[model samples]
Target: MERILVVGVTGAGKSTLARALSGRLDLPYRDMDALYYTGREWAVNDDLVATVSRLADEPRWIVDSLGYPEVRDLLWDRADTVVWLDYPRHVVMPRVLRRSVRRTVTREVLFGGNRETWSDWLSRHHPAWWAWTQHTSRGREIAHRAADPRFAPLSTVRLRHPRDTAAWLAAL
Candidate 1:
């Protein structure tokens, strides 16, 4: 699929799947986090909307996100295919937790040159907490988007579990 958007809850492995799809399809891959966060301490790109708009105008791309608020609708409107990783909370929570813990333990550098800290785990914005708290709501949001008439041209692939996603990707 061209002009793809890989969407899901915070820990649903959207980035991973998007990368795989990009490689498989020979499409350009873009990580929303890398584009949104541009500096240290998680500083954001002020021109994110404009930047994303430009990217969306391109002929092909695989963006790993439903997108942040400001650019979400634009991306959705431009996307021809949406790969939704709708894994349940049981799957998402452990993933987010393990990812956060590993990042903190290793002091791994992330987008914007930021690193996850044990202290960051206490923050509401932390991926683990966000995934846990927003799991159901995020699922509802994605469902609504998938059914919306405004995005009628879009073809959606909703994967309910990791195994389903694995098999789907393998087939692709």
Candidate 2:
């Protein structure tokens, strides 16, 4: 599987897995978040389509977190493998919370010059909150998409634990 899509709920280590896969497969890695969030605009921009198409032109790549239907189809449709990091709700929610708190406290820059703030951290839309809310939601989302004929030919793997993910990545 050359072109791979590493998908999961927020704070489920999607970017971490994507980087590991890129190294294991000797392919380039791209963070979909960087393309989706441009500091100039808070919302998704038009450049996303071009970036996705351009990246797909490469023979091998690992993309982390793609959710927009068009963007999802572009990568998911062409990706040879879909590795979902389906960690437990308890594990991910805590991790996301910790990460968010640390980032907000440190004013860490993320995704194209954007920085997490205390206000954002407290907001309902914070990724930490999203990680919690979207926990079981992803399974439901994936189930329907997995059933679609468009994804019939895909090589799918949903890893529930870090050990399985590590072993799979190491085997790659």
Candidate 3:
């Protein structure tokens, strides 16, 4: 539990879970999104590599994100625990959609002014769209990592339903 990867499809409560994990484990909470989203141009500066290296040296941390392959190696090599919120597609999609609506309506700035617009919400690149398209694809990849012999010692807790995830976290 020293280093935990809290992963899930878009809007599957990854950030919330990661925060809780950080509190429970007495570790730092790293929002990978904030670390990766660097500028107005949306380009990741070379500093991400350095940040990852620094985080890896720490004895404990809870990282929240799933799409950055560039930092995957650093995280995989250091994490001993992975909390996968493998909620059903039906559940995750609605959660994402609602979150989008709220953010857009409120003009909530996320990840340093990265915002949710109604038009973009309806677009293909929307978080909802990403969730729909990437859920099973990424989910399968995570499943493979959990079961693969190369990662044999990794402890993966795959929570299929929200209630199940809640119960598991409550007991932690």
Best by lDDT: 1
RMSD of 1: 0.7
Candidate that would win on TM-score: 1
lDDT of 3 by residue, 22-134 (tens): 88778899999889887654557568888887987899888987538888867877888889999889999889989988999998887756787877866777898999999
Q: Cα-based RMSD of the predictions, in order?
A: 0.7, 1.6, 1.5
Q: After superposing candidate 3, which stretches have Cα over 4 Å from the reference? A: none
Q: How would the candidate models be sorted by lDDT, starting from the highest?
A: 1, 3, 2
Query: lDDT for each of the candidates?
Result: 0.94, 0.81, 0.84
TM-score of 1: 0.98
Q: Given candidate 2, what's the lDDT at residue 95?
A: 81
Error of 2 at 104 (Å): 0.8
Per-residue alpha-carbon lDDT of candidate 1 for residues 1-172, written as tens digits (9 for 90 to 100):
7899999999999999998999999999999999999999899999999999999999999999999999999999999999999998888888988898999999999999999998898999999888988888988999999999999799999999999999999998
**In candidate 1, which residue ranges exceed 4 Å CA deviation?**
none
After best superposition, candidate 2 residue 139: deviation in angstroms?
Answer: 1.6
Clash numbers, per candidate: 0, 0, 0
Query: Candidates' TM-scores?
Result: 0.98, 0.92, 0.93
Per residue, candidate 2 scores C-alpha lDDT tens digits across 1-172 of 8888888889989998888777777889988888788774355666888888888888888888746666888887778788888888887887888888899898888876877887786777799877877778877786666567887687788898988998887776
